[model samples]
Target: MSALTGKVVALTGGVGGAKLARGLIECLAPDQLLIVANTGDDFNHLGLSISPDLDSVMYALADLNDPQRGWGLAGESWQAMDALQQLGGADWFKLGDRDIATHLQRSVRLREGASLSQVTRELCAALGIQHRLVPMTNDRVSTMITTEQGELAFQEYFVREQCAPAVSAFRFDGIELAQPLPELMDWLAAPDLEAIIVCPSNPFVSVDPILQLRGVRAAIQAATAPVVAVSPIVGGLAVKGPAAKMMKELNMPATATAVAQWYGELLDGLMIDVVDRELVDTIETKTRVLPTLMSDLESKVDLAQAAIDFARQLD
Candidate 1:
């Protein structure tokens, strides 16, 4: 895949999505790529605002995320968490000493009236990241999971409970009040826009929240750019996270083709791993068979480039 001619936009969440975003940053110039991060995982914890997916992408792009853990900062110490634990304070969510600084800055800036987009811009600059990063919306939107155990906040179900409870469905609390970021609307309307890539992220909790934002889906439908998605489900399992489990629990097959169906008409192209190539014939959307598991920088870059090529073919 050669260099793409115009601006590219990616809708992303945590971990897997962040890895692909890092790869895209390597391929596109600073002015050419825009990343819209999911804030549905945002929550208030221990008196600080925590935007998990935002920070995940931030850390991943900045080359600071812990490689072993796949979340939080590298070379981190947990003195703050240890102290908080000794004090018997709420510490189910481990906040690293270094990682706490990010939350502290974001929380204070937000409380002082800076929008999340503004704060994210500042944070990205501090880390020397040149690419543009935007939150899905500035207004409040929480991903609430309705489960066999009743309703729970996104982070509660994801982190605290370790996704133990079987999910029934998802509701984006405050979605009606949430508006799409103005830049997003403009990007969708931009005739020169090249592609809109949905990163290999959890569809239920990550990608869905961004799509469900007021008029985002309708705008994407109306956009001239091709919409491409890299299936998070490779084979019958998720590369990361509990997407596969959630799919089966929701009565959908946990396969790449099934993921294509989940996105349906929104996707002009679906990239599934070569392992699932046999199922390509079953999918209605134009599909690309490639190595979609991005374990390191090389593979991540390869997958990102493949996604770009697929998008171009769609056009």
Candidate 2:
């Protein structure tokens, strides 16, 4: 029998998180999984509201994400980007022709006064994704990266600057007024919730923003389900983004133990990579060392199963 049988709530970001999300979808029934994606990376580009993390998760679930690039649809064409470049338009963030359709539809719906969650649901239905995927909140919560140069928007620091600036700290603007999704709160309060898995995403920008939402941390702490996290850092390096660099810039060691410390008491257990097995004794929470790297589909599935199994054992 699968260890992940009951309803599971997963908090995730883009790329790394989506890869594991795909694995979880493969392992669990459609109704058994609920994904809450980070919206901190969202921004307005060319008058279109682009949600990078949400699109990444949705594409992964729909089997349309490009594995090589770790973002955007597979077999995508960049004709639109090329045309924009020809017109002297800013192309720092490449938006492919296929991806443009998603943004266009979402922008129209949003302009028509639909909530982000509602629009996301419609998009998921169109993409044939069975599992539920939700943004952290409908309200705007931009990730502000404070660096030596100055404060830069999340996308500017990440994409435009190529993360070259020395990171000092991070702040989620508008987070104070941001509300957690009503369904998410209800799920946390549900009596039969099996687990809450924090995917291997960037703690500072991705997962922290979700946890920082009003009443979210308290809800997780009060939940009946065990909360588990898969460390994004493996062998002192991040699987994709600049998580490791951020950790170092913030005067923290880039290790799985540091990640466990970041999540602290909210986590009942943590799944670290085998490469960081030696640091297990230092982790405050219950720890399971496994191959956390998701280089391929099979690896992603195995790691997902291992995390679910670990969370079940915690109960």
lDDT of 2 by residue, 1-315 (tens): 265658889999999999999899877887788899999999999999999999999999899999998899999999999999999999999998999999999999999999999999999999998889999999999999999999999999999999999999899999999999898898888887889999999999999999999999999999989999999999999999999999999999999999989999999999998889999999999999888888888998998888788878898
Show model 1 residue runs off by greater than 4 Å.
none
Write model 1 residue lDDT over 1-315, tens digit each, in one string.
Answer: 247878889999999999999999988888888999999999999989999999999999999998789899999999999999999999889999999999999999999999999999999999999999899999999999999999999989998999999999999999999998999888888888889999999998999999999899999999989999999998899888999999999999899888888998999998889999999999889988988888899998888888887888889
Q: By summed lDDT, which 10 consecutive residues of candidate 2 come out lowest?
A: 1-10
lDDT of each: 0.92, 0.93
**Residue 193 alpha-carbon offset, candidate 1, angstroms:** 0.7
Please provide TM-scores, in order, for all candidate models, with all chains considered together: 0.98, 0.98
Off by over 4 Å in 2: 1-5
Winning candidate number (TM-score):
1
Q: How accurate is candidate 2 locally (lDDT)?
A: 0.93
